[model samples]
Target: MSPELIKRLTEHQPSLIGLEQCRQAAVLIPLLETPDGVQIVLEQRSPKLKHQPRDICLPGGAIEAGETPRQAAVREACEELLLRPEQIQVFGLMDVLHTNTLMLYPYAAKLTDYDMTYSTAEVERVFCVPLSFFQTQKPEQYRITLPVHPPEDFPLSRIVGGKQYQWRERREDIVFYQYQDWTIWGITAKILQAFARITR
Candidate 1:
């Protein structure tokens, strides 16, 4: 095997940044074996939920205390999909992701069985798409630009034109993907995009 492949197989490390109130979370990229081929499992969050209601997502949530992201990923899959631990075989830990405040971990696991009963309170629906679909369909991209303007306070006392200093704007790229009737976008899309590249 190539050195890079070896590294990817061996490096399953976690990172914690030095920041307060920074939540750490994890998600499972549940791949199911089938007669046609391997497929990816995804979930739609319950509309009644407070966060990301009715959004299409992977089965995952916050990493509990004294638990590794790996542990959390499996626990979440079990909790959300009503699957036993033995039915899920975690294969690899992918790269970590960062949000405005949360640090997220993504794990790749294979589902040994197809039968599942998702938690109604947390999962609205469970769906699967062929891995080849993403291999063929590319996501649409958009960019958002935000220019920050500080308040016009009178505290610009002893600086070199502090109030008039030029500042740079921040830009973020948004991606969207359409599969028949579903629009997979945002963080979930990003995770799938990364997984697609890894597969390639």
Candidate 2:
């Protein structure tokens, strides 16, 4: 990550009151700069799960009762993708994110090899999309309806099967990526949005 990106991230402070009250979760927004460009890793959830089934998300899991959020983030990445903690360059921490269902700690990591293997039970696939997409795309491109107090709408997009899909927020920050046939809202988008704000 650039020093400018680091500086911007260091100064961020998103509200945590609501987050502290929910189940703690952590995710790593892994970054990689290829000949193609900077990319962010995302995972496609298996349709067999009961919660957030068929969603695009950062590799993560609920924080164990005894672990810190940072530890949870590193552990979840390792457990999900065999990403070793030593291989990651954790650039900076993002603001504490609150989903309607969980409190998420979003951490940033930069790695050279984004090689991944997925468990059919938890993840259906793993993929990467250029970070520039988020930086350059218009807000209208991601617009989608979300389930909120008043039923809100937001944009959603992610690379899957080598295609980009626009998602409509079906609720909160949760969106439905129709092309990939996955819902990507909640903690995942929250993490990406935080990165978008800092990188922009």
Candidate 3:
């Protein structure tokens, strides 16, 4: 990013900042490479989870008391996807973000293996999509619906050669690409958007 752009982004930091009433959640943005291009790890929540059941997400969870964000992210990734901390290379931290329901801190990581499995307890499925999809997209296509005021009917669109889709938020729906049977969405997509902008 240009210094000016970084400055502007930092000025907009309040929008990215999490709340002081935080629950200390952490997410790992796992990147991998294949002949197709660089890919990102994603997960589909179990249909049984009370919040956002069956929704697409990253391997993450609330940080236990005394646990650092890295510790929490590493532990959650291991427990959910059988991925060990030693197997992941930490990239860096992104700005904090919060929805009305939860405060989130996202960290980036690089994964070594393309082959992996998931535990059915919290994750229904695990998958990946090329990061190039975001390289060519814009954030305006994303929407923001307040938790207190959700849209009556959400709009859907096919993008990225039907490999990707989005559900309407405010003016835009969160961007998602289907990796195998898993659908990526929500804040996971937002974090991807931020990373794409920074890296591209």
Candidate 4:
């Protein structure tokens, strides 16, 4: 490889980091073009599964060892949505959301045609919420408190005071957009809300 090519490759490495060990993940925000204009595709996760079961989500999962976030997102879409690589065109990167244990990378893409067979084991149903709805209606937001609970072994000698030291936790908001019967919230809702704001 050329010297300049190697330099650019290293400079473009993913920025995800480990905080109590962050598990990298990626998802595709697919835009379906229809006669009605554009709609954002989403999946109702399989109720049979554990870990946030039955949540509304964009198509994605954990990033595999040999793939970049973009490749992972596209591969996940293919697995969950049964989309061939050629059927969709990736636009560009969206914002990356980092939680306590997960680093999620979401990519914006244009999806063609409604002919799709979703993996029933992974998805309960695939549906589209018209992009216009999100553009017009803002999501309901609620702030929840985060309380810090440190272990008894927490070093006190290093601090100016011992256990008397004051600690604070930041408040985080849980966003919701109720589309008919579906309650889209959490990370999925955050991604949708961000997309709506940017496209508006």
Candidate 5:
């Protein structure tokens, strides 16, 4: 409308509109060089935890205030895996994933000098899966429909077809990978699938 407002708007950088309302988290897809081959480091959460207990996942957690996603990834790895910062070499950042309730940042890194140690309080145990397995194997995918339910107080009368108005439905695909006795699914499997595609 005004030249001043136009100039200010042009100078601003756009970001995700509602990201501030989402919980931010970061994860490190640690690559360990073993005699067999390059392996992926994964962890199983302690069953005693309140959320997602005993679920297999990457070494990461919520991003704290004033901490960058990269920093959060490294810190979570150090805390959960019982390693120092120097032991982990962060190579690159993967694509950012946006879910209904979370903004997830994944980083690809190499782990060195790790002796399979982990914090028992947060992690039940750690295991390695050959990266080649993901490179060669495909994950099983299933899609779920997401329908929006508008509030009853809304003015449906203003819309065409009134209460019968057809609202668009959204669908999301969930991936699953069965590796030995471990079952990797949900966000973790999705991330791994992306990583496999990128690396391949």
Candidate 6:
């Protein structure tokens, strides 16, 4: 390689492969300071929604074009919770999660002056669970297997073993948290698990 080409390549920042092709989303893990302690604000999605309706989740949605993850998280929280931008103070970003089709950015924020308000069009209800609950209670864990399937047009004969080729299967662990009558699982629980680990 030429010296100039090497220098140019070195200056390029490395990022996740195929990240540009992945669907991006951002969420705010809102924290409410109360007399008891710090509570986590969660929402039940509107049952009429097309996506994960009635599912318990943090306030967030798809990252809009040209919007940063932090901006998306704050905007989603403000829209869903009916709070002013000043009322949602984002402190830090926890971590970025990668799934088969999604790239999720979870931000840690403090919600001020929020009065259990939410948009009925997007959220069915808003509730708070003590941060202590997650800090104290362990989530139930389960593993799921994902088998790889080749498309019908895929040329299996191009490989050595043909149809007998052993494709590696992927497995992922899922977590569930039971807080009172609420069942928190899937991506929401996964993010919470990460948060709990860091806080501990």
| Best-performing candidate as measured by lDDT | 5
Report the C-alpha lDDT of model 5 over 13-101, residue by residue, as the tens digit: 98998898999999999999999999999999999999999999999999999999999999999999999999999998998889878
Candidate 5 weakest ten by summed lDDT: 92-101
- After best superposition, candidate 4 residue 32: deviation in angstroms? 0.8
Which pairs of residues collide in candidate 6? none
lDDT scores in order = 0.86, 0.71, 0.75, 0.89, 0.95, 0.94
State the lDDT of candidate 1 residue by residue for 82-164, as single tens digits.
99999999988887777657787899999886585798979989888899888778899999987986667845655667777
Which regions in candidate 4 have their CA more than 4 angstroms from the true location? 1-20
Give the higher-TM-score candidate: 1 or 2: 1
Q: How many backbone clashes does candidate 3 have?
A: 3
Over the full model, what C-alpha lDDT does candidate 5 score relative to the true structure?
0.95
Model 4 whole-model lDDT (C-alpha atoms): 0.89
Q: How close is every model to the real structure, measured as TM-score?
A: 0.83, 0.68, 0.69, 0.87, 0.92, 0.97
**Predicted candidate 3 versus true structure: per-residue lDDT over 21-45, tens digit per residue:** 5566998888887888888778888
Candidate ranking under lDDT, highest first, comes to: 5, 6, 4, 1, 3, 2
* lDDT of candidate model 1 versus the reference: 0.86
lDDT of 3 at 47: 96
- Regions more than 4 Å wrong, model 3: 1-20, 139-183
Q: What is the Å distance of residue 7 in model 6 from its true position? A: 1.1
Model 2 worst lDDT window (10 residues): 149-158
Q: Candidate 2: misplaced stretches above 4 Å? A: 1-20, 99-101, 140-183
The deviation in Å at residue 196 for candidate 3 is 1.0
- In the range 40-142, model 4's lDDT, one tens digit per residue, is 8999999988978888999999999989999999999998999999977999989888877788899999988657569998999999899998888889999
* lDDT per residue as tens, model 6, 102-152: 999999999888899999999999899999889888999999999999999
Candidate 2 overall lDDT versus native = 0.71
